[model samples]
Target: METLKIIKIGGKIINDTVALQQFIEDLSKLKGLKILVHGGGNLASETSKQLGIKIEKVDGRRLTDQKTLDVVTMVYAGKLNKTIVAALQAKGCNSLGLTGADGNLIQSYKRPVTSIDYGFVGDIIQVNTSLIEILLKEEIVPVFCALTHDKQGQLLNTNADTIASELAVALASSFSVELYYCFEKKGVLSDMTNDNSVIETLDLEAYHTLFQQGKIADGMLPKLDNCFNALNNKVFKVCIGNPKMIVDSNSIYTTLQL
Candidate 1:
């Protein structure tokens, strides 16, 4: 069985073209990696603000109203997706850009917000791995944006981490795939104020403790949740670490053990 690697690149690192290109160059060297999922939330937010748009969030998740959804769709599916595909192509990697809506690769429903509705925000409920399997069998890497689709055939904004987790679950179930969630931060830290306070590894039990103790909050909370979700779904290995440290197994980061 050929091995596949599903990597999700952080939005912050995607902004640096030099770094992004270098990352692709590194990935191209890997023999059988199948897919890469990327996010551009920071860039999208900045662009929205420039266009005089206000971003609303609840519990660290973006509330994608119709207006904000338009901006994000352009940034994630249009600009960022193409940029990544081109970068990988320049590095000699065959890449195809896609979103959840393409072939309904990932199916989702509108996330219900009590008392207020986030127009186009969604919670991913299903992922169709058949399309990815075909692409991988052809040795073509599928680069995914975090955009999903609702049952009504409308595009919906989703968290990139959630998208990656769903994809990881689907791919791992059908193939040998390693899931890596790369971020700008070094890893999950025991103490957010200290860079050296990184937790080297975590298990399902430990993760629950951290969450219950209020140790993980804000952005880190969702990321950790995604990691656990992937692990629970039988992904062989899931790592949360810096993008530059991806090639180094010894580099400090949290590896979620199944």
Candidate 2:
């Protein structure tokens, strides 16, 4: 089986033009099949505030009410996806921008209203591995935005990290998949305020300990959940770190092992 790399990038890299450009350039240098899954940083929220819409979140996952959902769709599937695709194109990579709606790439349903109502937020149920495989075989790099849809046509907000993880898991049987969760920090930090405090390798036991101690909370919580889920399902490697580390080996990063 060929090796496939599914990279998820979020944090400040989404809004930083220079950094995003450099990151895409570096990503293009990586050989073999690859997919890019990206998050909407403050773009949705900022756009919301401008339009007089309120943004809400529960556990760092946005509560995608109807109004907020529209904004996210525009920002995530529109401006952001195209920008990344254009950059990758300039670097000589044939990039295909995708919302989970396109080619029926991802199928999901709205998150259940349990203790709290998550509104239009989605819980992904399926990914079309065949479609992704076809694109890869054609040498097309997929650039995915954090937006998925119900096969019935309703668009839903999805988490990019989870998307990357699920995609890796779906492709694992056909390829040796490496799932990467990239962001602004060098890696998962022991001290949130210190950039140098990267935990080089994180295991399931350490992850549980951190969660119990309240060291990992909010957004990091689901991301770690996805990481462990991917590993347990047989992803070859899972990583969290600076985007540049996707190309540069000397760069510091965190590698997750089960």
Candidate 3:
């Protein structure tokens, strides 16, 4: 089977012009089929503020009300997605920007209200693997934004990490998929304040210990969950690290294994 790399980039990397340019160049050089998933939460938050939409969060997860949803949809599906696709194109990589609503690439439903009503938030239910496979076979790189839609015609704010993991899992039967979570940090840290305290390798046992000890929390909590999910579902490899680690063989980073 051919190898497929599904990399999800977020945090400060998305907003950094120089870093993103370098990332695109490196990605263009990667061999085999690849997919890029990106999150622009910081950009979305700033856009919401500019549009006078109050950003709400509970446990560091966005509360996507109607107005905030509109802002994110425009910022994520529109601006950031196209910017990355254009950059990839400039690097001679034929790339297509997409959202869940585009060609029904991803299907999800609104997150049901429980304690807090996260208005337009979505939990993904399915990924269009056939469409993704066709694109891969055609050598057309699909760049995905953090947006999903109900088959009923409503776009919902979806988490990019989940999107990457789900895509990796869904395609594992046909491809040797490797999922990557790249961000500002070097890797999963033992000390959040110290960037040098990177965990060399992380297995489920270590993850549970650190998690129980509260070493991982907030944004990283869900991210780690996505990592394990992909690995358990037969993704060839899962790594969390600096963006450079994806293309750098010697770079120090966290590797997740079952």
Give the alpha carbon lDDT tens digit for every residue of 17-133 in model 2.
899888888888899999999999998899999999987877666788899999999999998999899989999999999999999999999888889998887889999989899
Q: Please write out the lDDT profile of model 3 over residues 81-166, one tens digit for every residue.
A: 99889989998899999998898989999999999898998899998889889999999999999999998989999999999999
Model 3 accuracy (lDDT, Cα):
0.91
The global Cα lDDT (0 to 1) of model 2 is: 0.90
**Deviation of model 3 at 24, angstroms:** 1.0
Best by TM-score: 3
Residue 189, model 2: lDDT of: 79
Model 3 residue runs over 4 Å out of place are none
Candidate 3 weakest lDDT stretch, 10 residues: 40-49
lDDT: the better of candidates 1 and 3: 3
Clash count of each predicted structure = 0, 0, 0
C-alpha lDDT (0 to 100) for residue 248 of candidate 3:
96
The TM-score between candidate 3 and the true structure equals 0.98
Q: What is the TM-score of each candidate against the true structure?
A: 0.93, 0.96, 0.98
Shift of residue 53 alpha carbon in model 3, Å: 1.5
Q: What would the per-residue lDDT of candidate 1 be over residues 18-74, giving only the tens digit for each residue?
A: 778778887887777668899884889988999999988775667788889899889
Query: Which window of 10 residues has the lowest lDDT sum in candidate 2?
Result: 213-222
lDDT (0 to 1) per candidate: 0.83, 0.90, 0.91
